[model samples]
Target: MKTTVEQSLRAYLDDKTANGELGPGSRLPTERALVAQLDAPRSAVRRALDTLEGEGVVTRHVGRGTFLTESARAGAEAAPPDTSPVEIMQVRLVIEPPVAMLAARLATQADLDRIVECLQAGGASSTFEDFEAWDAKLHRAIAHAAHNGLLLSMFDVMNTARTLPVWGTLKRRTSTPERRGCYHQEHEAIVGALVDRDPEKAERTMRVHLEHVADNLLGRV
Candidate 1:
């Protein structure tokens, strides 16, 4: 059975995830912070962190801060042999809109900075591979700003699926410079909404963006 301190700490983290306060790869508060915030003993905080480490939900470095782990992400991205690119997009459609909404509600300045960096990089990319990489980074940054580990892990899976040869083939055929420019505009719109902290706008923009991408892939819009 878990101690009260451990249980309380877990509940706190869960609540943070729900509220977008603790995104994937984001560092956890220091033991001093945890002790103060949770009103628990230092030993209790240490033990709770230790328990999370054992569960693979977090990792601790000697000097660096504790961080959410990629264990779940690795498992989520283990694509099945028969998985299709369309299926991956289907999953993305289901997950990404909500992530945008949460990010709009909770993104910090740091998160926005990282996202903007990716956006700039994407725009400056001279090659398809480079653009796609920055695109992935931008999307991942948004998901991270959502502060939901599970959702980010799910995104990792879908993102990995996009790297499949089939996806590469299809995108290569359809991704004209014109289309890439359109995607950049859509990404800008989504980021604008996030910066405004407008959850409804963020959610709607993200949905429309994904829909456009899907239609493009299917040669519909």
Candidate 2:
């Protein structure tokens, strides 16, 4: 039987994933950080992580940190086949603006903290790969903040589709420093609206951001 601390740790991790502080292939916080954050003994944290590793929810590298397993990130269903980048963008525009609005209305302090963390990380990223990873994380974080499990699952499926090779190719082909800076600023605006708890503004800003992304990717000025 699991100890109470172990159960609590599992629940904590579940919450973290649901709120986008952790995701598929994302590193877990350091054991020291977890200890401090959870106010639990280091031993218990280690044991909890060990249990998760054994269950295949996470994997630990000798020199690197623990990361969520890709299999663990799958939603209730698999992504549909052969989704083009343009189609993905279209679907995102339809789904995400409402997600942002709901996030604005419902986000907890912890959710907001993680969203801001992703934003800062994306802004600080030097490489397009790093920026894109954080960009996805930021959007997923916002989706999770909506606190609707079905919407989150759908968002996760959409996000999985984004990992398709064609999507990456298009994103790489279109990437530019100026465009990246503009995206960061747009991200700030969306986050700012969420922080202010303005649902309408959050929805509008999210739509505008996605529209800009669609235009950029489709080569429409």
Candidate 3:
């Protein structure tokens, strides 16, 4: 699992223990169960368990499943490092606009198709979870469209940050029909610039979109 994903799972598990949902010696959820429950990949769950075991937060037994160690239950109240929404937005502002520019210049037809597909799917979503998944896909497609390996890797890191539980909590609280509608328009504008092969317009539109999202998340603009 990526470091960000591990941290996210660790934070969530710590919360569960702190809330008295799982006591010392209690068996943790199966890897498959954690994957489904956290909407995470199997690799992430496995890695998180590995990290927990290393931290003395969990114990893995062959064929018996993983269990929370006694120390974990007692130490679970300690919070993980903070990742504020503002900081996330600041990072996006630095990286994504240029990515949009490069993507506009470089995107293949297939990349455009995939990005459009994600947009359409998101627009059709009836629930926030479904919408959020498509939203992430859309951004990822754009990042891939940039066609730079390093940029793609950096974008993956940002995307991982988005997977933090706090990100979801803030998104769910801030998302509304009006904001969603605005986002749809903003997304379309960004894609429209890309379809036109207008790098400058694409970059500008993407930055605007990111700023709009930040504002919505912060209850500003």
Candidate 4:
């Protein structure tokens, strides 16, 4: 299991990479820099980097600084298979409740802050495109809060699948203002459970939210 500091560092890296701040073969900041920036212990920083290197996300050299692996960058941009909305929902139902449960158990103050930011931004969105973008951000924030590297990686892949044209077309066809309002409430419930650190409630709320989404997207539970 990762310590809180290690998890925080991983989430930081994930966010940086996603936003194109750190790209293929980009050198990571120095250990001293990371420690100061993350307010993390040097040892914890080293450990996090070690774990990431072991996972093939980075490379280290004796005199050179760490660099993101080319493969890691490629993997993030790779296209997923053409999966149906029902199939994606099935996978989400199986994976995300547990993810939310973990987030409730593990999310730190910073994680909670990011999740709430996404939630508020999504709720305030005026267009379906904006709302959908924030919706993806909110889910990604929750996944990061889970602080399980492998699970986060899997969620990233599943999220990529959602970018397919078919998924967007279906969502556009099915979207209604009422449904979006319902989704906002559901998001609030999920975040509330996380803030309360109620793992069981978090899991239940996440399952409920996904079931509603599946019903909207697939026209059946």
RMSD of each: 13.0, 11.0, 11.1, 12.1
Q: Which candidate is the best by lDDT?
A: 2
lDDT of each: 0.78, 0.82, 0.77, 0.81
For model 1, the stretches where C-alpha displacement exceeds 4 angstroms are 1-69, 219-221
Ranking by TM-score: 2, 4, 1, 3
Candidate 4 lDDT at 215 equals 83
User: Cα deviation in Å at residue 147, candidate 4?
Assistant: 0.8
| lDDT-superior candidate, 1 or 2 | 2
Model 4 agreement with the true structure over 38-123: per-residue lDDT tens digits? 99889878866754553345667779999986556544455456678887788888889999999999999999998998899889
lDDT of 2 at 64: 97
Rank by lDDT, highest first. 2, 4, 1, 3
lDDT (10s digit) by residue, model 1, range 1-221: 54577668767776776598776777888899999989999987886675455334566677998997654336323766467767867888899999999999999999999888878888887777667767877888898899987877677666656655688788898898888889999999999999999999999999999999998887432
For model 4, the stretches where C-alpha displacement exceeds 4 angstroms are 1-79
Clashes of each: 1, 0, 0, 0
lDDT of 2 by residue, 1-221 (tens): 54466567767777888898988889988999989977889987886675455334566777899998665556313656588887888889889999999999999999899899889988998888668867887897898799987887677777767756698799999999889999999999999999999999999999999999999899432
